[model samples]
Target: MRGGPAFEVLFNINTYLKKKGLRDKFELTFFAPMEKPGQKMGDKALLMMDKMFKSMDIHKQVGSKIVAFESDGIVFENGRKILSDLTMFISAGTGHTILSSSDLPLSEAGFVVTNEYNEVEGFEGIYAIGDSASLMGAKWRAKQGHVAEVMAKNVAYGIAMHIQNIDSKRSYMGQLNILCMMDTGNGAAFVYRSEKGGKMIPLPIIGHWMKKAWGVYCKYSKLGKIPRIPGM
Candidate 1:
């Protein structure tokens, strides 16, 4: 796990392993090409992660890119090799190759370029949302499901306003925030980060159930079997 929301998921796994007394049985190592991973969450969250890593005896490899993966290990660009029985690597996001052949303006990463309102710069009445559209905001900004939903709503509103000849438009920028429920097998944590700061609230047992409930709600609501709660 490098950084962003995935870091919390790794932390949740760590918590589960430790609780089950299986942490020492398997080696856990987090690798990232960046020197300071998780810095996007701010200084306080970084400090907390450092403390957790030290307490859990988790190994971290940073500032080294992986050149190749062998049957039994991984080779780093610096000629260092880390041998492991198993490896789980998370890759950074890249736009679909189809975008490269399209007329849409794209970033170096191939993400379609868009304005604050998710409107394509040169494509009239065409908007790109979700991971397909490049996000513009703080350096820490990331593509997320909630953000995508907001963009969809904004695009719908934009279309209605266009038909009505209204000047008002909605923006997804003001709603940007990191809100996630990080769950371990036995417990969970409420993680929230915004312009103000970041906070992680440990919820011993009920938090796990809360996440499960949210998953059920999402599935049913999407199928149109259950009405979606406003702003859920």
Candidate 2:
């Protein structure tokens, strides 16, 4: 998912299917290009996740190149074949297909070129924020709303200073962080990371309600029915 890790997305889908009494009817396996995907979430999170997946009977195929997707399943470069009834794919990061035809400079992933302040090079008064901008950070880095929100605020400040003839600018570096509220159907986990490292705190029933409340707030705030809570 755009907001969550591929493992979490696929696992949740499996959870949903299980709720319909279909757990024994399918073989669910999670695949990713990264060997240890979700490392950004923290080592503790990954350790916990592995045990959780095993308990749920989910298979994992990661850090392996997919040779091909045959009619029955997947073929790996190492001659490993996993029979899968269906396959779902999501890139780590990608851009619109239309961007490939545009004149704007693009990264290897097809995201737009931009400076730390989200300003497009060779084009004054132009900016690329959110998923549009080529991200800069650790291999564990991800493009989440926190990063996008910081870019948005910084771009606004940078443009305002430009108009005032002030030689000032703000960089999104150091401000962006990894944050996620993961729901496991029953409860949830609060995941966060920064220069100080990362943490994943498991929350019980209350966590589920908290996430639901946030969902409602997100929906209404986007629709102008309510104001966004600060630093959300």
Candidate 3:
């Protein structure tokens, strides 16, 4: 329960209701097995999140493991049952099932083991990147698009250097950080967490377009119709 998608879902549902002017007519609740779902974002962000929930009139059911999902409600390990007519559930990330049968080394969570350069150790010339590779670093680190980009860029550079007999390389290690632009229907929020600390910047109408602009840039850059902004 890293808390990213859950918050997104909460905001999305809340926004949709507000747009229809029915926000006050419905009840919303957030449930999780962890005491703090988005703990990785640091204490400040977590506090802000709690405040957001309160402002939106959303209830919280946290800190107990879910044991069952009944027809009319969900049950928690602590004997609490939440009644609901509609429910949206999101599970935590896990390695692919195919990796379970492979001989490659895997972490306890089942992700493929890789070095900072994304190379598979003991398997020369082989590499595993993106969500396929087990992240090497602090436990708080969660996979993000920027981190995947760094890994892919590094692997490409590493392979080219191998072919040219160059001894140069790049690493995703130095690039690890949390970057997310969460859309809240009418606006968005810019969240960033680096080695220095974590920060959640509120962005309204301008922030919404900022994320949309990036989406446009990303699509065109991938299609080779426009040059990508360096270090984007």
Strongest candidate by TM-score:
3
Listed in order, each prediction's TM-score against the native is 0.88, 0.88, 0.95
User: What does candidate 2's lDDT look like per residue over 1-232, in tens digits?
Assistant: 2436555566677778888998798888877655887787779878877876898798888888878888888888777888877777765568777777887889998999898989988987989999888998776678887689899999999999999999999999888688787877766778888867788887866877888998899989989999888766
Worst 10 residues of 1 by lDDT: 1-10
Q: What is the lDDT of residue 232 in candidate 1?
A: 83
- Could you give candidate 3's per-residue lDDT for residues 1-232 as a string of tens digits? 5468768777988999999999888889999998888877877888888888888889999999999988888999999999988877877778999887898899999999998989889999989999889998876698987788889989999999999999999988888999998777667878888778888887977887887899999999999999988767
Clashing pairs in 2: none
The positional error of residue 166 in candidate 3, measured at the CA in angstroms, is 1.9
Q: Lowest summed-lDDT stretch of 10 residues in model 3? A: 1-10
TM-score of 3: 0.95
Which predicted model would earn the best lDDT? 3
Q: How far does residue 59 in candidate 3 sit from its true spot (Å)? A: 1.0
Residue-level lDDT tens digits of model 1 in 103-127:
9999988999999999997789889
Clashing pairs in 1: none
Native-referenced Cα lDDT, model 3: 0.86
List candidate 2 stretches off by more than 4 Å. Answer: 1-5
